[model samples]
Target: MSISPSLDTDDLDAREVTDGRYTRVQIGAERAVKVRAAYTTRFVATEFTKRPEDFHMLAGSEVHPEAGDVVIARVTELGKHTRLESPTSRRQLLFVGQEIMVAYGNRYAPDQFLAHVPDSLEPCHLVAGGGLAGYVIETHASIGAATAIEPIGLLATREGVVNLRDFSPLQVGSPSLAAVAALGSRRPPVIAVLGTSMNSGKSTTLACLVNGLSNAGLTVAAGKATGTGAGNDPNLFIDAGAFPVCDFTDFGYPTTFKLAYEEVRNLLAAMIDEQAAFGADVVVIEIADGLYQGETSRLLRDPLFATYVDTVVFAAQDALGARAGLDLLHDAAVPVAAVSGLLTASPLAAAEASAWIDVPVIVTYDLCRPEVAAALIPVRAALL
Candidate 1:
């Protein structure tokens, strides 16, 4: 790391080309930060809103990384993830020596990798395609090593290190989740989509429901209550006719794996409120991973889960998973409205699941029907 000659800080408006690379701006006479081929990703899109001149300084020394703390890093090695997901959902390719901007966050994916934020700005892995930088603690055997990146420094301003939460619209002066849920004296029904495990088809089921509800002449809003930060699910919901779709990331969370139960509830509540405020007739939320996962298990057992969610659509990968999943939800006192997932793709498996549990087993096409979709929502009048 080379420290160029300190430039005048008094001329805040003055722009100078430094090192023929990124513009080097002087926060003060002591600190000199340079911005080079930095590619900002989707993780920091909410708070990385500063213009080129808006005090985009970098602090290299005494770097302490925390979840949602935006940092610049140089791509050192390309492995499993060769491209990053941009704020606009574009996949930007990575190359050695190229700089990129991402956030520090923990990840929990049984089918992929489990990673945590590193204590120092040392070499770390690109644990997620959403631009999450962390050191992977564990990974599935099927996947290769994570992409590697060397930390350049933390993104900073005059106040301090720039955190995603600092500029989050949902967290800054926002009402409490309870208060938000109580507005208008009438809360819309929330259909929570849960699954047996990762890649169990939870996202597809949610999207199908969104499409079905829209065809039934009801305004639907969708949200992802927990998961590693990414744009794929939200984009799918939008294509399915959901309006004002939200996820934990919107609340400045890169991932909700280790979040407290209250935090997860608030994430769900805030998203539901945002959709309702936008005049949605109903709201649907998806809980990442399976019933046994940490956050998901705790949330289901807690009473708060029932307050905001009216029904649960259990998604399973097999007939046994569907049966076992329904049993788990039942044991947790959760109401199961329907069962759908990979098992539904097989008529034999679907029939087996239906025979095993009294709940109706449905496929994607079933959810697409206007009448079937409209019926999934428990009579709203009964709740009020």
Candidate 2:
């Protein structure tokens, strides 16, 4: 087998090719080891559409692993996450000794665990249901400890450690600020959904708006700009009639937490370009977490972000959060067309928010309506 260019060839002499399906590599000159995994591996969400046959070897020599490196691990204990989300979106129950394939990534969900890739392959936590493996530093008091797992080794092929980046279906070569700026009226109007925090109904708002736009005879493309990797939101967008749906994960990132600002900006640009290539009339993107979150705040404040977003739909759980969130957006000069989310579920709370903010407060039902959804589009894009 030809060695992949991306593979680390430093230890080239240590590994020798065999005629069988598995290759034999000498860990040291004195010892020749044929490492074989006897366990049936259950793949996770981040390994989307990959099969066991895709990888031929496992290497545990590396102590420090980077985010997006695929690893094979055995469940040591089941805690908050008793089940893992499969690549097919099925919730597979977890067992104490089950071996699973997952990707390493940092998690920044305040409602859950804040985790980072471990320096060593020591026991770590499954931080997100999306198959992120990291060492938990902090977790919400309301939730139980994260699920524990022991790393067997990183999944590898002739190319070396299999990274999701190597398998991305997207052809988004490079981010071009000039290209995005030049689109002007030719590109579709983009609406961004931002929330007070995780689970503040941002996904629902985006999905509903997409549904309304699709119902209004417009092709809608949707994506989540930043967040931990997960299928729930993307699936929701698909069910709501969004074609060419995307998220940070689709670009090979298991999560957007801790990523550089330029990387995140380029990711947003790529997502829009991917959807626009499909001839979408409007694009909707969701930014994970509240305005105060580091990555979210940076994206909101960046001038490049303004070039991609036409307006924003703010999601909040209460009147005070709605008011505060709107104020923050206003301060950042982000154009917010409406207020919706958990706050809109209750008439009293929505009324209170409406009284405090000048923007219209809308509910899911209203957002699904063609006329109401069309109104949310900025006049420039709408006219186009």
Candidate 3:
């Protein structure tokens, strides 16, 4: 990729941009370094991986930014869009789990899947038109009123269905996603928690991070974009003194399994917005599923998540997984703050985790220690 000549860095204040975060600045002479963007919004530098976890977000505004170019973005909190249609019928789209289907007269019929709607969504919602298998959607796009779509094909929705097959809506002018589809000119550092499989302590680590940060005299806002809503991570964040704590429970998905990509990104954006609104100093988001799982693997290496993450903490089960996670984060340029896990009796487990991941590893036997949360702050801060 050709490097553009840098313009005046002084004039390129991060506070100026309203929507997008500056990925690479064209300043006078100096080349870009591993420095913060003018805005804190996240962008990916690259996507394809020759190494472990070398994931990136989609290509950005840069011209000819190579296929593997890393994309870094400033992640905003999750944004929520709820709609009540004119006929006293209410259509709500949570950031996750719910799909936004755009009905095309032929294949995109919203009523097509009336029988196949998930058992979880049983009793099928009584949509305005008597809940057509395909439902009408309303979008801020210049298009007219109803875009019929099968509920299952939906990636996201507010009052209208958004098809994941063509999800440009979250890109720019996505009235429901970002303020104006522009990156937040000014963004903030992000904190993320990832794990090595289901039940690997991801949410628990996130709670600890929120509590740890809050106890350290910093404002904290917590978000749970995915998960089955088994534990009360949101409640834990609130109880730990965070100003505002939230989870997909609020959006109604309460889990990440059925969510599509468009739905996930919008949910993430909405959560960021929510956190920012709370004015918290740190925003923590937890990613469910293993970092290397086939289902969520794409998101694990996702540039969106990477760009938004200031620090990434991984929960592991053993030294091997710890090593794999550490290597992945190192390749992606996401800082690994610490490793958390539960193990049987192994004296060398902590040492093994620390040596491999190159960060402090905390093994909790009590599963009820208040001090466990505090232990993470100093270790995490040191990475910065």
Candidate 4:
């Protein structure tokens, strides 16, 4: 894939990511991290819908990484959709202003690579830098109305980037399923979280649960599944009294687009294994995006979520979405513990949603209302 001019690949620098503890290298922070792993693939900038110029600059250049930049990845996998794959070559190097040496051992052409991307599939690229690394996939719209990721301005523009410091896939269980599967073969029960939408009260709700569960003397370990990697959801969970919390960044995937369906499942299973291995009494998880919102959502319906998550919570914005979410669960046969969302924050809204979904509706603010999260704890445990 071609690098974007807006990326300023012209000025690649090897620097520390704010905290000078570890040297930043490649498309990730530090040398590497055994943390929650997140995945995303970078696409051509000219093709970008929002910041179009990111790809326009590197129209024909092949990635010849130098200094800090390491692998110049070419899509090795072709699919019905535009799925970018990571090339397996350790020799790939990240250098300063290194116009990828095209003839070295005959690297594949970017145009040739794009040729295989099906017309129906959305396109993206993999980006790397000291400050911000990993794949930044192109999206038509920003995630949700109540976006979980709020960019904190005034960030140091080291090597010109701003990766999500808050909830990354960098700190999770393991990198692959093979290991996770092996781990799970010898582990115990694990606690997990699931959801229906973006602002569906997953993270905040997870924090509240952790606080309560911890108070009840459970050794709680928490983890965040997905979100815009720009905020500190895991930190919030940690502060909420979780002894340990992790996100995708710890796993090494910078964006979700970089992960395949089976890969995500395997890694999640691995995370469950790790959490169980950690020996936390109850594991709390925050799911990314939402269930029933995409083709993947259908996957959630097809017994996949039941297989993975211990308890499922549907977060909705309004009564209509809440009802729709509940109906989707019924259709998919997903046994959910309870429903919660912005509506619960307001009394009138909660009452409205309660009318739509018979399941107990929780508004985290009024935790004293015993029915809010009280009823769902057992349901969640049943899944575990």
Count of clashes, each model: 1, 0, 65, 59
Task: List ranges where model 3 is wrong by over 4 Å.
Answer: 1-185, 343-347, 363-384
Residues 137-212 of candidate 2 have per-residue lDDT tens digits of 9989999999999986666655566666766555356533544554643778889999999888999999999999
Determine the backbone clash count of candidate 3. 65
Q: How accurate is candidate 2 locally (lDDT)?
A: 0.77
For all predicted structures, in order, the TM-scores are 0.87, 0.85, 0.49, 0.55
Task: Report the number of backbone clashes for model 4.
Answer: 59
To one decimal, what is the Cα RMSD in angstroms of model 3 from the true structure?
Answer: 19.4
Of 2 and 3, which scores higher on TM-score? Answer: 2
The sequence of per-residue lDDT tens digits that candidate 3 reaches over residues 182-267 is 34644445677887776677766676666666656667778776644323456566776666665653443323444567676667
By TM-score, the candidates rank as 1, 2, 4, 3
lDDT of each: 0.77, 0.77, 0.44, 0.43
The better-scoring model by TM-score among 1 and 3 is 1
Task: Give the Cα-based TM-score of candidate 1 against the true structure.
Answer: 0.87
Tell me each candidate's RMSD, in Å, in order: 5.6, 6.1, 19.4, 14.2
Two-way TM-score contest, 1 vs 2, winner: 1
